[model samples]
Structures are given as C-alpha cells and as structure tokens.
Target: MKLCTLVNKDCSKAAVLFNSKKRILEYISELAHQQLPDVSKHVILDALMTREKLGSTGIGKGIAIPHGRLQGIEQILAMVLVSEQPIAFEAIDKQPVDIFVAFIVPEGNNEEHLKTLAAIAEKLQDKSFCKQLRHAKTDQELYAVIQGDDNG
Candidate 1:
C-alpha cells in the first residue's frame, strides 16, 4: 500500500488553484474520471461527498486524505494535489488544507481500504514531507516527493 503504487505523474498535481474544499473535490473527481474512464465523474463525486458528510477527511496540518469506495473499481486509485493557498476543510485541528491525497477504492474492500488509508496518513504525518510536497513546482516534482525523493 505504497503511495507510489497508487499515484503517478499523471495523477499528481502542483500549485493547483481552488477557493474551497468543494472545488478541490471537484478537481479530484475530474482527475479520477480521467484515470478511470469507465467510472463516471458524477459517481466519484457523489461517493466522495457521501464520505465527507460522514466525517471530514481533512486530517490536519494542511493535509487531507479525501477517500471513498466505489463500484466498478477493481483496486485503489489515487490523486494528489497541492493547492496554491490553503482552504478551509473543517479538519480536526480546524486548520486550512493545502495538500490533498485522495483515493478511490473498490466498494466492500474495507480491509485494504483502511490499510491504504493508514499508510497514506502515516506518510503525510511527516511535517517535512508535507512541506516538500507543498513546494513541488511541477507534477514530476510532486510525484518525486511522494516517492520520497526530495532531491527533485
């Protein structure tokens, strides 16, 4: 359950501009749709929104892991975005979010889903890693950071 396995250069973004959490979610949905053409964008958005209502995915310290389970997905898919500015996400710490590590997992696979979520959370807990992700200037740089290569 490595971030590198779930995310790639195409799914990673840098310096994205969005005004609110909803807008950021929309962007994530769009990226998910592109990666998974078989799944509709609306379905992805609906699933994510439903999960958000249950609890804010915004973990804290300018980081968020918005995730949801969806039908028709065989495995976990991920997208990462670094916002140009922090946006309110109703996180536990009541802090704004600037880094989004979103995931779409197959429905009913609770075990793998939780495992992957925990793995991503563990990686994001590192303040320096989050800082490097925020400062990434390009999609390639962002992917490099996620792969634990700060030299990029």
Candidate 2:
C-alpha cells in the first residue's frame, strides 16, 4: 500500500500545465489508458469524476487525491501530477491544489483501497516530502522524491 510502489516513473509527471481539475482528471485517465488499454478512458474519467462529485478530493495544503473504484481491474492504478501552478480545486480548506495523486482500484476491494489511500495520505502529509515534490524539476526527480531519494 505504499505510494512509491503504487506510482512509477512513466505514470508520473512533473510541472504539468493543468488549469482545471477536469484537465488533471483527463490526464490521469490517459495515463490509466496507457497502462490498461482495454479499459476505456471515458470510464476511468467517469469513476474519478463521480468521486469528485460526492466531494472534492482536495485534502488541502495544495494536495488532491482523486480516486475511484471500478470493476474489471485486477490491481490498483496510480498516477501523480504536479501542476506548474496552483489551480482551484474547491478544497475543504478553500485552498488551491497543485499536487494530484489519482487512483483507480478494483471495485470489490474496499479494504485495500482504504489502506492504499491512507498510505498515500500519510506520505503526503509530510511538509518536507511535499516540498521535495514541488521542487522536482522532472518526472524522474518527482518519482525519486516519491521514493524518498534525497539527492533527487
């Protein structure tokens, strides 16, 4: 249930230009499509959007964890995106968000989903870790920061 284990270099991006939450979700859907070609990007977007509709995933402090549960997925899919600038996300704290960690999980495994989300949330809660993420210059650096590589 580690965030680093859930996210890989290819699935992660740094300093992306996402002006809106919709664009961020679309990018995440594309990433998911790349990993799971059989699953439609539209379906992926729908799942993520549905959760957003219930409430903003924006956990404040410039972070958002947009997640969804879907059938036909054997394992969890995660993608990370750091925006070039903060974007309005309607966060509960009423602050803008820049860091996005999106997840697509198997619909039946609620326990796994919660544990994975908790792990991700815990990691992001670290101010120093988030500072490293925001300072990452490239995808590799971003992935490294997620992996806690200080030199990255």
TM-score, one value per model: 0.95, 0.95
- RMSD (Å) per prediction: 2.1, 2.2
Supply every candidate's count of residue pairs whose N, Cα or C atoms clash at under 3 angstroms. 0, 0
Give the least accurate 10-residue stretch of model 1, judged by summed lDDT.
143-152
lDDT of 2 by residue, 36-129 (tens): 8999999999999999999999999999999988899899999889998999999989999999989999999988889888878888888888
lDDT of 2: 0.88
The superposed Cα distance between candidate 2 and the true structure at residue 40, in angstroms, equals 0.9
Query: What's the residue-level lDDT of 122 in candidate 1?
Result: 88
Candidate 2: regions farther than 4 A off: 149-152
Cα shift from native, residue 8, model 1 (Å): 1.2
